[model samples]
Target: MKKFVALWLAATCSLALFSQGKPTTKPMYLSYGPTDGKNIIKFNLLGAAIRNYAFYGERMLSRKVSLILGCNFMPRGGVPYLENFTDDETLKTLEVGTFSFTPELRFYLASGYGGGFYIGPYYRFERFSLYQLSTTFDADEEEHTIDLDGSLKTHSGGIVLGCQWLVGSRKNIVLDWSILGIHGGISSGNFNGLTQETISPQDQEEIKEDIEDALDIPIIKSEVTVNDHSAHVKIKGPWAFIRGSFSIGYRF
Candidate 1:
């Protein structure tokens, strides 16, 4: 009877071991992928050949999801016509600078392969300083000089979406494409110095009187008084961009 009891116990233990599955272990960090222990970096060169010509620089942080910081420089030049006057034109030039910060979320399409996409929103703070020169050529020659030593400040927020295709997984040779939609509020302070010199005093008085009568405003008979103005400029809307580039980096 004792021998039979020992044999039954041994059979039960063998059945339990066979029915239970083998123990599972977690994957080691290094076995995951090349990016398991490192960061990524990128740079860009951009140019606009439109109303406003501009240049941009961008830096991206290293991580599963990264942060991007960038800056833009614009040198603007244009010839504008005055609606109040017929056949009158004004030529002007200005320089503007903008800085931006954004957080991005990366989606890995396939694990162990070095390719993914990202999307995010950004806040941009912009500063504008104008160094403008204007000239008007009419039957009677008139010259105006303007200097804007004061700086303009504004805020803009936007959304950006893009994708990246990496080549040679270990080397970090990535090609990226993206689109940006931006909008914001703007305000400007004028430190503008404007001076008007007519060909003759008679022409000066004639022009001054016409301006006053047309506008029905008080006339300052003096030759000139410094004019400074300040106002809020609205720059809210949707703007988009498409970019593609190749960058070399590393992932530890």
Candidate 2:
């Protein structure tokens, strides 16, 4: 009876092990963000074509955390409607060039590598170079030309919330969309010498109202400082944008 009991016990243990079966690979293994690797890089297609040519890259700290960095370069070009103005020795059309840098810390809700809902704090810096803007006006049956020269720079920081979607599991394509973002920052302008006359308050108000209405938002938060030689501007209070991106990347 003892021998028979021992054999039965061994047989029961074997069957239990068989039923349990070998553990399948972790489900996260199939997921990139759910499972973590090393790095992924993407380029902003729209940004490249648009005014700012931008490129972005990401490094995974963990399955749920990552850091993002981006750089943008915009070639110097004349401002809109600049052609309407004339360029000469003292008066010339204004041109602007910009370079920007951005850094962000992102948290992924559920990761394979980097997709889904994310919220992060971002800091952005932009450098701009300004040129002269010249135009002609008629006064007293005579033509008069005016030139305005200035330089402007901007810096901003705020929270950004966005969503990412991945398609084609084997290929693993990534798409990112910034649903809504808000930021407030400061902008300043300086002129070596501005020889144009300032308009009256009524004219200023009319221009401001027209600009606000056209933009669908109130701009010109404050004319921080306006002196004979230079001026400072603030762009704050309410600012928002919807940003999106389409790019390909490698997950390792």
Candidate 3:
């Protein structure tokens, strides 16, 4: 895609410029996204298509170790529910916006300042807030509604294995890939406003059993959140990904 090409070129060029300015044994570089990954405090126009904007900075702590700090944001958009609600009232319900912070420590196995194969541990925290909704749903083909409000928080940590490439004369065009990565975390929801009809244990079991058929949205089966009073829920699960990145930036 044109976006990817631009991202790689921009990241590479930006990092190259940074690298040229300073002469130090310790390598310092800046890069950004699968989209626009700017070194300085800048916004990504391309990543905005997916409602994502990412910013990052990196410096080598030692000859073989580097630290990267990154933040990604969705300014005006929110994550969607697992399933689409059919009714007008349900459709009108609004969720909250989200942002994430990632801190990573990389141990380079290959020898280079700009490009190398590296592996490391990364920790990411994602927060979603300002969510409050009142919507109706069908239970046992009977219609009912509940009001709820809550914020969701996720804490995750994992390992990533990847390599970075340099393209420019000074190797500033950056292309990086984390061929494999896995993260596990607990997702918690906190809420207080729950108004609904009394539900029996059997009813809860039934709802859990055929959750897909009962509700308009689908959450992970393994990570189910439920309650008798107003239906408060929290889910714990694992997160995994194949991460690839491209950035054009200066290296110093």
- Best by the TM-score measure: 2
**CA lDDT, every model vs. true structure:** 0.42, 0.60, 0.60
Judged by TM-score relative to the true structure, which candidate is superior, 1 or 3?
Answer: 3
Q: Report the lDDT tens digits of candidate 2 across residue range 1-252.
A: 999999999999999998889675334433454345456667666665656677778886776688989887778875544446644433335677778788988887765357778887888777777665443333346644444455556678877778776556543566777666565576655444332555445433543453344335355444333333222333334333334555555554
Q: Candidate 3: misplaced stretches above 4 Å?
A: 1-47, 78-96, 130-134, 137-147, 192-244
TM-score, one value per model: 0.48, 0.59, 0.56
Q: Rank all candidate structures by their TM-score, best first, as comma-separated numbers.
A: 2, 3, 1
Per-residue error for 52 in candidate 1, Å, reads 11
Score candidate 1 by TM-score against the native. Answer: 0.48
lDDT of 3 by residue, 225-246 (tens): 4467555544334444334344
Using TM-score as the measure, name the better of candidate 2 and candidate 3. Answer: 2
Q: Residues 33-72, candidate 1: write the lDDT tens digits.
A: 4545334455443334322232322333333345444444
